[model samples]
Target: MRQYLILLLLFTLVQSAVTDSPRRPNSNPPKGFVTTKGSKFVLDGKPFYFVGTNSYWVPLLTTKEDVESTFKQMKNAGVKVLRTWGFNAINGSELAAARNSDLTYYQVWNSTEWVLNDGPQGLQRLDNVIAMAGKYNIKIILTFTNNWVGYGGSELYVNWIGGAGSTHDVFYTHPKIIASYQRYVKTIVNRYKTSPNIFAWELMNEARCLGDLPGGPSCIPGSGTLYHWYNQQANFVRSLDPYHLITTGGEGHFYWKKPVGFWYNGQFISDYNFNGQAGEDFDRDLTLENIDFGTYHIYPQYWYPQLDTPGSNFTLKAWGIDWIKLHAKAAKRVGKPVILEEFGVTGLENKTDIYPAWVDSALSTGHGIMPWQFGALGLTENGGNRVIKYADALINGASPNDGHAFYENQTTVWNVFTNAAKVQDAKSK
Candidate 1:
């Protein structure tokens, strides 16, 4: 069985089942709009940098009337950009409403995350987020998926959303599943192809469709469906929009260095067939240009001191530097600049937060870095009140302007990130 090769047609049918929202206005790149590689973003030929905690409060800073006020806060702090999350809770009551509905499965069980809802389920709320980002001159690295991968459970449901996976996602070799992916991607990209503020496409969040095992899977549609799945995805992003750049959210360690036959390289060479590329001398870039850019993730406690958080002091930022060098080298090897998409240090671990310094070293070396998060995760109000409390100081106090201080538990990483906010004056320009 050749297994569904009518790619373009199969994509069409899949969209009918998952289709929700009607088309909206989109922002296309202007004529001759070439995104040049610079220290920061180059919108229409200028320098830029997206710096800020993955801000949760910034989006809701001030009253509803001043939604853009958060971006201003970043600007005020001399921060140029904020790595904003997709779904955010507007009304706490909605959380209850979603739980009562059949929507929980669609949202990775995180009702507070608004991005998971498709169609009218969360259209208005999402629009406000996009509008707020635009109003503040903030460019977004909008991720379609969440950190649902490693958490397990219902994530399998999300993974199987369209055909074993969509056009690029070859989760399983299932017939209809692969077809469904093709359609799902076409629908989503066609709807948003022209959004100027949508900096790029992040197909999913930290996904590992293929298990971490040797001789597991590869680029070909075979034992390892993850590679084929990713190819379908990466290709879909390019075909539908053909404007904005795109990359996998973060497939974890494999994103950077994979085994000789790993899927990242295997999909093109065949993961199960490492020697398959030996005929071509295993040229690394065969599928390198298949994607627009490169992305990677890191777990410090796992890689560095191996000490559980608050106790470990793994300071290599090893992947960060290697990512820049490897991907940039790889990008140049294939003609693209690398993007350091996701990396996070647990704020819940041992009171010390080394992430800020970690990030500083990476970006100072001049790689595009999007730290894990902001808002309730790192710098949100504590002890539950309208008041905003940033984990800037271990002491836990109110922000300026008399905002109250509330905290869950203060980690050293929190204060370092808060302090680093001042160091990122580069974004303002």
Candidate 2:
């Protein structure tokens, strides 16, 4: 009788252990690393749906204290992921002539070779940003380069190899340029390959056939040039770091179909998004073996300025919702989770009125949403008096204000994000 009772107690405890734990049997990801299962993101064996935000200036900030404050404010608003620039290249000539010695840069191109800046005001700044994000329990998506010229993008590479007259698209196919990019990528990937705080390595920001400059004769859109480049770089990063996720960081343009039209306000416009002129095929790119998920951005005002006017046949709100639905449908077909990675409106009222509906659609469709940018309040000295202003407004001592930033001071817009984050958290369970 005594032996029977002891065996029965042991069996009950085993059952309870199996039932109470959230982890699935035979499923384990590296501690704190996020992995995907089917159409959902899995972290520690459970589905992980989240609300995140972007702040490209975080790594370029001058101090660790500022970085910590940025992460803390984001955590307070329920941001689980952050996206920032990982590459900042400058020509050695430009560096030598620059008036600001305090500026941060990751790579420099000399006459014969490329030099990586890993000291203070360089990669070390990125190191601090990552460390603070880890301390605050947030993950980061580091974008390797930009399609635009804001922070030394593909154009810079072309300049390094072909001088002033070279075309922008060669950055994708030029053998020497590709090798230089690979060298930089390998260095960054190996440095933090073991860190669990990295959510993904973004290949580039808004990659298109045309960048700050015109494309060459060979830079044909819908020609699979960008697609091939993405595949090569993604495979290279994976070889260096198998733990982190990868994404194209394109604006989610599609080339499979051509010239789809949509009503904007009162007039009909050909949807350039569906046209292959951007050298992006949303569906095709997501199908890449190493590409983990899909990402799309919504900025109706920028994409269709006509829609911003009153009395339109279709409203921006309606168009944005449809955009979300379309991408969600695509994710289902591809069998991977997709994120509405960056989106925003110009007005606070527009955001307050439209964001909730979009968030609801994202939640119902099992998609994650991250606003274009997150803003925080910070203090600075002005003539011996302390002044409070948006931290982003102080970047490089000037605001890049694309008019999409939202902050804690903006209670209504801020609530929409915070509440949606809570709802996403609840649904993840």
Best by lDDT: 2
- Judged by whole-model lDDT over C-alpha atoms, candidate 1 comes out at 0.43
Candidate 2 lDDT over 1-429, as tens digits, reads 999999999987764443232222123548888878988988777788899999987775666666777798999999999999989888887785432645668888885358989988789989999889999999998899999987677777888786778888889998788878888888888888789899888999998888888887775655889888887787777666667788888888877454587775567776678877788888888888778888898888788786567776768889889989989888899998898999988887888898888888888899978898888656221311221122333642232345788888789889988998898788778
Give Cα-based local distance difference scores for all models. 0.43, 0.80
Candidate 2 RMSD computed on C-alpha atoms after optimal superposition onto the true structure: 12.8
Candidate 2, run of 10 with poorest lDDT: 381-390
lDDT of 2 at 212: 81
Q: Encode model 1's per-residue lDDT on 294-363: one tens digit a residue.
A: 5555554444443233533324354345544544454455454455555554434422434555566655
